[model samples]
Target: TGKKYNSAAANEAEEKINIAIRVIADHVRAVAFAIADGQLPSNGGAGYVIRRILRRAIRYGFTFLETREPFINELVAVLSAQMGDFFPEIKSQQNLVTNVIREEEASFLRRLDQGLQLLDNVIAQTDGKEVAGAKAFELYDTFGFPEDLTALILKEKGLDYNKAEFDAKLKEQKDRSRLANEMTTDDWVILTEGNTESFVGYDQLENTVSITRYRKIDSKKDGVQYQLVLSATPFYPEGGGQVGDRGTLKSINETIEILDTKKENNLILHIANTLPDNVNTSFTATVDADLRDESQSNHTATHLLHQALRSILGTHVEQKGSYVGPSRLRFDFSHFAKVTDEQLQEIESFVNARIQDHLPLIERRDIPFKQAVEEGAMALFGEKYGDSVRAIKFGESMELCGGTHVKNTADIWYFKIVSEGAVAAGIRRIEAITNDAVKAHFAQQEKALEDINGLLKNPQDTLKAVVSLQDENAKLKKQLELLLRDKAKNLKGELATELQEINGVQFLAKQVDLDPTGAKDLAYELGSLGTNLFLVLATADEGKPMLTCYISKELVAEKGLNAGAVVRELGKYIQGGGGGQPFFATAGGKKVEGINDALNAAVEFVTGK
Candidate 1:
């Protein structure tokens, strides 16, 4: 690679720098959009994918463009400006996106430095020109330092980190991550042929169906399992956040247990434990009716929760994701802050009022997707839409949905929030339960209230009683602090007596009985009394070691004594590390017994011996 010293020369070179710039721009926009969608760079999950994308672009710039400075952050504004129309969120979240990118850039640079230093250290020990891959993998796993960056730097120094060994390490990590989602599936063996499978679970719980094809699978998580595809089956495949229906397949004397129903491509696969005896015989596919009923209620409640969230949190709120189970439903939406208690109460009331209204479910199928949208039906952002779509409506709440729902809102019984929290930046999640689960929630609440009342000796007003007890606790804490301060004042005298002179420097080291802040106050008071003083205080705090260092302003200028350096050096004895300004510093550590050693070390700092 040639280094172009001038701007015009760089453009004249063209391919290297220009291609690097284009790749960086394209990849940075992808990362920025992901962050705007509330998935930021993290060490795990989807966030890790975003991190790798950003780092790859940064590496390209470093290698091809000769970028000594971080130019990735410069691309964020360009990305936001160009892609802001369709994804206006990039512009709305520009500040966060840019700051997050800048932080990632700084972090990557720091880890790169550490990796290079590690390489230099390894090279110094062995007189060889090659570095071990284990050391490189250590940097990658522990510091998130990229192997590519390590290899590039090593090449520039005429050294190399073992690629085969590094690849093995990489493969190990990838395989471990993939194991949880792995399945060994055999090709489908057709027993009987027919058109694509059709679902009859929405209209009926049982149907006589013919087998189209079946396959066997083996997974580490679940042992040997068989997946059967049937024509005109009554098992609802999992989709749109609804759990798969479970039941049994029976034909005469044989019964095969249906474990789960899931759709792959245009095929609905019924998972079962064993295969039937006669492959050509027709079987009755039955769905668990009770489970389907509970799931339907929760699915309807999810729609209600979506509407309530949009109404309360402005019209900008949109569904990011959702999960519907028999006992609970979790709805993820786009929002910046947490929902308050009052807002939650209002949301619950809104859903219950709609339930009490008993709005009938209006369903329409075989409608154009755009036509449904034009007719005021809400569409999910990331869902793939076909030419024809299904619309589900409950009075004012209408959405493009295909999941089974209750015939009436009253079937929901009641809605209750289980928890609310942030899933990512600009995304919040609300977990809730409907119908029978709500009864369990209420019983748990009642038991909690009863326990609190009994703890307070059956107070007439439990809340007031608890508040009064809190006030009493605050008063007691204040009194205890006053006594500690008085005790510290008396101890200050003994600490002063321990002051000694070494080489015309007033040096003191002693253990005290004050909290960290109180101990610092005592050091400051003592410093005001004299000049050319070096003071160190060691105190034990709840089985942990803590120390403070203070140097007189004149001593810092004349003797060049640094409090931060001294405390950090002494902190090693206590198994801790810290730093501060030259005049004062503090540290905390795990070994309380090292407090005495830390104070003695400070004394050694003054005396040559």
Candidate 2:
């Protein structure tokens, strides 16, 4: 049996359904990839990614699949069982995941139902004219309604929609997003096999290396720079948000300055201005010993800080990102809010305590990733791991890492936190330094403090000295305010006498010598005197002209006047624009001569002859 329906409406509905299906399929594939990597459904990076995907899928089903609420749960359960071996945590947390998805789905359905009611209002107000596809798409994108749902509701109301136009708009947005995230890389050239790079420079400063493979790349700022992969280079590649290493790569005859070392794929590429003339010749690879030593100290200090955070804050604190360079180390971790001053002090004290203890660093190579975890080594949240990883431990502080480190915690000399703040929604970051950098940082601080103390005659207590000076400054400020108020009062009476009657309204226009704030206060006081009073004042201070306007409540209604519009129109003369309520407004101008013209315009507006 066939039900008579509009052929166009049916086709539009089918196209929307197809697009939703494609979105759902892409999400499913992303989940499958996460599972293949042995990542579990926990409250971390990969876990959050999976949860977001599942919630989106459930919302899509409610909007487009036209199935009941239980359909998404059933689909997730089926997928979980098929992939349970790869991610046992998914099955273990199935009930929790389902409950979360169902709750989100119910909430979104309620929002959609409310949005449909709003749509009906828009349609009724629009009076049967076909709504633009762009507007309809905006409603869907911002309010999370499927396009099919939009079309369905519009069809029920006897209105037409351009589904193709909506799809085109959607596609354009997707194209822009794709372009923003697209990354390109050139293919790697392999030079040697079985020549794994080592990091002996942590203990020793220099190493012997032969140049392996090198290539040239063109960048926006610097053109035609060479990138070389060396055999047994000592440079550490930048990872976990730290800047790369930079030093000298030299042969006996020629020297190439290494600007940076970074790892791409599994290869460490050394960036330089040019490659050495003899590609096959062996050379000395040297990292800046001072920088390397400082970096190692900071790197180990970060481990201590990480452990301190877990002990003082909670075990929930996980490393989100890190940067270990020659100068400083910046650490990012998962935390919901700002680290309090007391907590930060505690963390600082704890790391310094460990440094004082002189804890020896334990390095283990070629450890199985699973075994490392079983031994309670902390793996970073967003890092992708392989079958094997290197573990570094400073007593209880154990983590899977490959960065260079000091032989003992005492080598750190000192740890100092430079800054701490939020990096993202639930992530906080701490930037700190160690060794010579810490010494240098404190030296700079001491010099500044000395300068301040000298200016204050080297007070016995700096804090009390500064507090007394601040109190005196506040008293002086209060006296200045009182003087300004007395001046304003005198000016107000003189200004009131200057007011003239125009078109049966009290019109006052003048170019005052007062500042903008004073002029505004004067105008407001004048307006408070009586009804139908209009005031406009302009002042030229420091080669700039400022204007202020005020109108009484009755004058605004009688003249149909808007001070905001008047200020906007007058702003062109002054080269600045501003707006305010009908009762008050202001503008600033670069041309001092334009103040008179603006005053004339305001007078004409009030007179209205």
Candidate 3:
């Protein structure tokens, strides 16, 4: 807090220095609070907003403060001390929040150094005082470099760019993004407006209900779609990291497939591609039982997994994000490092042990949020809780959740962690499968083992057989290299006698029977023997043609001969082009028949005919 802040030496401005201090102070609070609430800086959406704020703060420190090292993370302790009493999350998660910011600052500082070099190249290529705005935007879009930072660097060099052009490019990108995600909704067509809708999915999978209202939505992505609201529905809308339920609706006249279920403004909306023939008649709403059961298994497994992680890793671990679906479950949590292979095995074993214990689900339909928390229910930081919350518990694992779950832990036959990795600076993600997915995964693995065994000729010990085969292959490779070298040596002597004198230069152009590597070795060996020598060697291996050219340094300087230029000109015969230094070059092509023609034309470069 006592560090002095000032502008660059060239500009000794007091007001600018003060601005930098205030900017760092204000933006750091936003970053810290957001991280405590489980929002990490990333590349898109709200995550990107946090990232831009942090980078802007770091840029200020780098420019006006003249503080180049990672100093922004140091302010986190002060922020926690001042605001911790009122906002306890910052105090509890101070270390985690600090590390996330520190990583981001270090990463951006490295990029800032690279951006300076890139700007220098851009300035060198510019012939006038102005650089292209498109180039500046490319730095921002492609390389994560700030455009304003580019402008600032350019200004220091007495250069500027057209701001209007950059703004236009930015706007065009925004417009394209909006068009891709935009959708328009019409007013709800009221059918039976007096009846209120209620969700009965927790107790049943099918219920008889009537359409309360309907609306039509149009979007470029998903052309004309309809959303129908029912009087009483048994479909669970997507929320609490669980996917929406899918099923169908049937009336006396027609049947409509419900593609998905979602909630908006506390109203359950059933999405369908077409409207039913009789919206006024009573209909049977059925939720897909198989899909619902699979989702429930995964959703319940997440709770058990959360408990296992906290028990093994530490109490500091908190849920950042999750996705529970019919196929797999992905859980993101805050941790300082990678979950090691040993820890992952323990976590998996813990969850599977709970499944074997056959703990029954203890669900409370409605309870006061305060009372629920007082009873030691784990509430996620970012989620907004109302006056009442639904609590789900399985043995010692309890959390305030709105997602559907299984009746007992035994419903989850087995739990398997397939992968664990880091998604962001301090966030780790674990992807796992359960029930039918675990069965399929093991079956596929067994089949792969069988294939490997067959490839090894059903050996008594598969691993030993594989090791022996690898050793034999290595020995064969060495023998092949020796044979190729001998062949090149034999051809070298025969080709030396065939060299012809052209313009006081020793020249030879021929197609060799050896491979590309052998031809290159033979050309280099012949070139070392004499001065003013020019060589062109061509080889074809499996229908692919390779042309190698080597020119002596004396001839390259005296006769203006370039092996690169020569190969480029002659490569047209084989429909290929390549270039290298003035002394040596190589080209490859698809047309093997053109090898002889390319070799025949090499004499013109030496004779100028």
Give the per-residue lDDT of model 3 (tens digit) for 1-609: 344555553454677787889899999999999988878899889999999999999999888777667889999999999999999989988999999999888889989887876676567568899989888887887777888888888899899987888899999999999999999999999987575999999999999999999999999999999999988899999998999999999987788999999999999999999999878899999999999999999999999999999999999898989999999999998888989999999999999999999999999968999999999999997889999999999998679999999999999999999999988888899999999999999999999989999988899998899899999999999999899999988888888899999989999999888788888888888898788899999988777888999999999999999998888778888988666788999888878889889998999998899
In candidate 2, what are the lDDT values of residues 481-503, reduced to their tens digit? 77766777788888889888888
lDDT of 2: 0.75
- The segments of candidate 3 whose C-alpha lies over 4 angstroms from its true place after superposition are 1-3, 6-18, 65-69, 468-609
Q: Which lDDT values do the candidates have, in the order given?
A: 0.84, 0.75, 0.90
TM-score of each: 0.77, 0.71, 0.79
CA displacement after TM-score superposition, residue 560 of candidate 2 (Å): 2.8
Error of 2 at 475 (Å): 1.1
> What tens-digit string does per-residue lDDT give for candidate 1 at 147-236?
777777888889887778878988999899799778898999997666767887768999998888998999989889999999898888
Of 2 and 3, the candidate ahead on lDDT is: 3
Candidate 1, 180: how far from true, in Å? Answer: 5.5
Model 3 score (lDDT): 0.90
Which regions of candidate 2 fall more than 4 Å away from where they truly are?
Answer: 1-204, 539-545, 588-594, 607-609
Q: Cα-based RMSD of the predictions, in order?
A: 6.0, 9.4, 6.3
